[model samples]
Target chain A: MNRIACIISYDGTNFSGYQVQPNKRTVQLEIEQALKRVHKGQEVSVTASGRTDAGVHAKGQVIHFDSPFRIPAAQWPKALNACLPDDIRVLSARYAEKDFHARYHTTGKEYRYRVLNAEDPDVFRRHHSAHVSYALDIDKMRQAAAYLIGTHDFSAFCAANTSVIDKVRTLYAVDINVHEDELHFILRGNGFLYNMVRIIVGTLLEVGYGKRTAQSVDTALRTCKRDDAGKTAPPQGLYLWSVQYND
Target chain B: MNRIACIISYDGTNFSGYQVQPNKRTVQLEIEQALKRVHKGQEVSVTASGRTDAGVHAKGQVIHFDSPFRIPAAQWPKALNACLPDDIRVLSARYAEKDFHARYHTTGKEYRYRVLNAEDPDVFRRHHSAHVSYALDIDKMRQAAAYLIGTHDFSAFCAANTSVIDKVRTLYAVDINVHEDELHFILRGNGFLYNMVRIIVGTLLEVGYGKRTAQSVDTALRTCKRDDAGKTAPPQGLYLWSVQYND
Candidate 1:
């Protein structure tokens, strides 16, 4: 059996996120169903790098599945895209080694959180971005993000429900960029706990808004208590940009 | 009394055009309802630039409503946008002259039709564009479009149900530009009869595919018969771009 890797993009608006939930629609379940239709009526199971919450979109989410059928690698992308729903698309497909796992083999990951920084609410992008009406000092946000990089206990930036015993995680990079109407938080990390990225973004946003200082990030990182961190931004603004692998 | 004008943009995927209909939801009716709520229990009526068929979208569609209660012109754009549904947005608003009419005072109009010219469909833009997998010659289409410009009898390109007696119309410009996977057909005209723009685009697309020659456009214009033109393209790809007035 050959391991097939697929790069996917999804709107995630109508989905219950990337995981398969019983009796609920999800991006992973839809992909599996489409694979079944394309693979001669055989039910297929797929494993992804990570599961995103509902309403969280993706650009380069990776997944892998083992199949008995032999099909051209070039045809797999089109065939899967045709069978998949309009909100989800298989961008690329390739054959990989048997030991290649989408989740376990990941070396790092990148995520972006978009906040629509505007006075008036954006009606069209309401579902795709979080609207922040208050003015923010992006320079301060950038300064605060500098403190977030490197290995530290991220329990303060994680959700209360996270079951991980080790709160230490290595953040490779964090950058904040501001456009006319958007503020983007791009983060690269070895691994992220539940809502860690969003919480970090929220804390940085508070610093940008003058509610907290640039040292607030260091304070949150040092203290492994969840209550010391800022709130989690909405899931709609969060996107799993890409998963890294050691080639 | 105030004559309020509003510029609106809509994603027509879920709308039944911009006009009111019995038992049908329309952009006009939705805005009117929102106005009624703002008018302190007074029912209101709205007039738009023209009627767009169901599923057609607009970016610069204009409308006017007569109101006894005055709303600040600067604030009206936000007021209506806030109360209106997510699919429709009021881009701008101004108080118009008492005799100003959105349809009658229009000096010229612009329309654009988008065709996705790629083998693989774009899932995110599926609702806003028409998918055409076949190869198209942009030069051929542009050459064919030249013949359709200027004043001529456009009955061949008009829909069968069009009630206009004079089918003669002047097309100021017909541009066919292709960028990567998208083809934009931007047409500027004094006015368009029902399905005129779509039929012209369809005929030009046929010319691009070598199914018809560039000379066929002139022949169709001279013939003044509906059979001489190609089929009407889908409404989803059509956008009422802007309406111009001489003031």
Candidate 2:
């Protein structure tokens, strides 16, 4: 038995997301179906590093599947891509040890959220970005992002429906980069709860728009309440950038 | 009545191009309907620089319309954008002289054809560009493009079914620029016949791939026969970039 690992990229525009859902098209299901076709008639289950929500895109998602058939690792990527849909692509594939796990072996993860900061609507970016018409002070948003780094209780940033009780997570860094008509929020952490990155982005936007102060992020972390944070950002602007694993 | 000139941009993925077809949706017909809605039940006819083929995109298409209503010229661009579909956008609008015409007053026309030169299939660019798996020599393509410049009878470049009798046309320039994995063919001419740019691009590609020689272009032009040229490139990769007028 071989633990086969693969890197995947998907558009996520017409998909329900990275997880399997009943009767709905999903990135996992599509890739699995493609794998099944290559395996002749055997069924395969894949485990991903994380499950991104619907409308959330991915560039370097990592997944692992166990297969009984001994197939050449180098040829698996091309075979998968040949059978998969155009919206999903298998970037790379390799054979791993039986103990290798895609989610459990990950050391860190990176996510990015994009916001279109402009008055006039961007027709080309309507589906891929969140539009913010109001003027935002990027300096203030950058200042607030510094407070969220390091180990802290992120209960305030998590969604209200999150099942996890332990809210402590170590955030390695939070960087806010601003372009001409777009703002990118890059977050690196050991692990993230449900809707945590989107909530943090929303809170930072409040500080940028002058509705909240730079210290508000620290206050929200201390409160340990979900209501203290801003609304969750839309799913379209969120992307699972990459997952890091220590071999 | 002042001639209202407007610059339009469209994705061209859904519509049947700029011209109105019987019982089919078109960019022109949709904009006209939107203009009628804004004019409070008045009909207006629009004339464009050239009729783009189906599935061909445009960024700087010029069109002119005459109306009896006195709408502010500065507001026309925004007003038209608000009513047009998401795939179409009015970039700019202004009032021109009564004698200004989109097709007649045009002095030069620019068109660009993009080909994705790669073996790996790009799912996202499938609809926007042509995927060519053949290896091409950039320098050879550029050398062949130089022979196509200046004035010549372009009968061989036109489609075989075209009905135009006058085949003489002046080509101001023909440039072949290659990027990382993209080959862009930019052509500037006084005017182009049906599928002329696509045919030229196809023939140049044959030259670049060593399937044909550069001398074939001149020979085909002298032959004055459509069969002498290569096959017409796909319409998906072609874009009507801009139309210059001597205003």
Candidate 3:
């Protein structure tokens, strides 16, 4: 069997989440179903880089699965896209080394959060962006984001219910970019815990709104307390921008 | 009585059209209903610059309504948005001259057609852009668009069943811009006939695909026959960008 890796993109608006649930729509379930069709009804389990919450979009999520078919790697996207739904697209496919694992081999990940800062919500972008009508101080948000860069214990940024014992991770960069009325938070890291990106964005937004101070980010990291951070931002504004793997 | 002019925007994926029809959901009906509620159940008539077809979006549609209440014009958007659905928004509102007519006093209109020219469809933009998987020659399309930039009888580029007798209109400009995998057709004209923009876009796309030559546009213009032009493009790709009035 050939181990094939693929880069995929999905619109997560209608999905329950990236993982499969009983009788619930999910990005993984749809992708596996499409693969099953290609395999002539044989079940094909696919492994993704990570799970994204419901309503969280992805532009470059990676996945891998073993297949018996010997089709050309370049033609895999066309063959799989014929079976997949419109919301999920296989961007590229290639044969991977037998030991390559989509999840375990990942070196880094990038996430983006979009905030629409305007008095009036945009009708076209309502589903894609989180609307925040109040004024935001970009300088404050930038200041808060700066405190998040580098290796640290991100327990405060992760979901409280996560069972992971090790919450330490290395953050490569944290950037806040403003375009017109939209603020985009771009986070790149060696790895991320559950709900980490959303929580960081929420905390920085609070700093921008003057509800929290820039130094609070440092406190949250040092204390490793989830309660010290701000509320988790909504899923609609979050996008799995890309996943990185050591090639 | 006060004459209120509002700049509105809508995602037309769900509506039948912009015009009010019995038992059919429309942009006009929603606006009128919102106004009635704001006016304490008193019916208010509204006039728009023009009607957009089903599945056609708008970013800057202009509408005028006469209201008996003397609320400040600046507060109109906030008040109406409270009652309007999420798919439509009142971007701005202001007092208009007593004699200003939304439909009659309009001097020109701008419409945009978005074409996603890529192998895979973009799920996030599925409702907003038209996808064409085939390769298109941009230079050919630009050459054809040049022939369409002038005053002419556009009968060939209009819907066959349009009741309007006069098909002559002055086209101020027809620009084709390419951005990544998308092509934007921006058309500005003194006025347009039924399905005129879509038909023109269809014709231009055919030229881009090498199905029709650049000179065919001139022939279609001279013949003024509906059969001489290409088919009408889908409505989802069209947007009423703005309306210009001689203020």
Task: Give candidate 3's error at residue A201 in angstroms.
Answer: 0.9
Q: Which ten residues in a row have the lowest lDDT in candidate 2 chain B?
A: B119-128
Tens digits of lDDT, candidate 1, A132-152: 999998888888889888999
Q: Over all chains combined, what TM-score does candidate 2 have?
A: 0.88
Q: Candidate 1's error at B224, in angstroms?
A: 3.1
Find the candidate with the highest lDDT and give its number.
Answer: 3
Worst 10 residues of 1 chain B by lDDT: B119-128
Please list the residue runs of candidate 1 whose C-alpha ends up more than 4 Å from where it truly belongs after superposition: A39-41, A115-124, A133-136, A177-184, A225-228, B134-136, B177-181
Model 1, range B91-189, lDDT digits (tens) per residue?
Answer: 889989999999899999999999998886765567788888889988988889999889998999999987799998999999988777899999999
Over B1-247, each residue of candidate 3 has an lDDT whose tens digit, in order, gives: 8898999999998899999999999999999999999989999988999999899999999999998777877789999999999999999899999989999999999999999999878888988999998899999998999999889999999998889998999999999999888999999999999999999999999999989999999999999999999989999899999999999
Candidate 1 CAPRI category? acceptable
Q: Tell me how candidate 2 scores on lDDT.
A: 0.87
Please, what is the whole-model Cα lDDT of each candidate in the order they appear? 0.88, 0.87, 0.93
Query: DockQ scores for all the models shown?
Result: 0.43, 0.40, 0.70
Candidate 3 interface RMSD after superposing interface residues: 1.1
Clashing pairs in 3: none
Global CA lDDT computed for model 1: 0.88
Indicate the worst ten consecutive residues by lDDT in candidate 3 chain B.
B66-75
- CA RMSD for every model? 2.8, 3.0, 2.1
| Model 1 TM-score on a 0 to 1 scale | 0.89
Colliding pairs, model 2: none
lDDT of 1 at A77: 88
